[model samples]
Target: MVSKVNSQTKPRSRFRSRNKLSIKEIFMWLIIIVLFVGMLKVTTLLAKTYQENQHPDSEVYGVWQEKDVAPYAAEQLIFTQDGVVFEGGVIDTNFYFDGKYLEYQHGDTLRRFKFLNKDLTEMKMLLSSGYQPVFQMSEKFQNNIR
Candidate 1:
């Protein structure tokens, strides 16, 4: 006698079927993704900062003295690869130059200086009160005083 298969009974699949992730698993995956993205952003920021610190503007990376200072006086501005150093040993690293002008953030104030000549030897500080103080490269100042 031939046996008949029942309509309600189905054959099992040979391959294991994938089940949907539970709410906890989904939340965990989301957290991991967010953390990974955050890490990548921080890494990119650090790399950019490193590159900027490594290569500063060559034209402005030296000591500059006030144009009208006395021969023996030492009123100067020092620029380094790391930052701009003031007389009192204050260093401000947040600075940028766009060829024509250099601007730096100091505490709550933003200071700017404009290049006055093509040789990049002369620059003037642009103050808000309209008092522009000229500065010359240290070497030029020394030559003039001699």
Candidate 2:
């Protein structure tokens, strides 16, 4: 007797399928990339705005003493946003003179100076005129003193 076999009853393997991506997964990845790029642009703009507000004005004022004279010469220095003005000069360089009010504009701040003779009486007059006495000396004056 011969045995009979049926080929149509055989089962297929589970790994034999098409490898494809779903539409939903592709859409999710695109959204993530766009959000990252937008965040970077916003951060850059914020940094620029902060830098612009930090600097108020470029002008500055200060006092320096001269080096050549016996007594240092009182110096009133002014620096503009672009450059310097009145490089060097003596305040009340000659004999004791009544203090006079010195006025100038630097950026937004207003600066005033008053020169007085060695005598204390003259210095009082400057004080009454809204000018503050910054320095006092009795000997010869020098440049770059301070």
Tens-place lDDT per residue, model 2, 1-118, is: 1232333323233233324556887888888899999999998888646644542222112232332435544443433333334445332221211124334444554444454532
43 Cα displacement, candidate 2 (Å): 0.5
TM-score per candidate, chains pooled: 0.53, 0.27
Clashes of each: 0, 12
Worst 10 residues of 1 by lDDT: 7-16
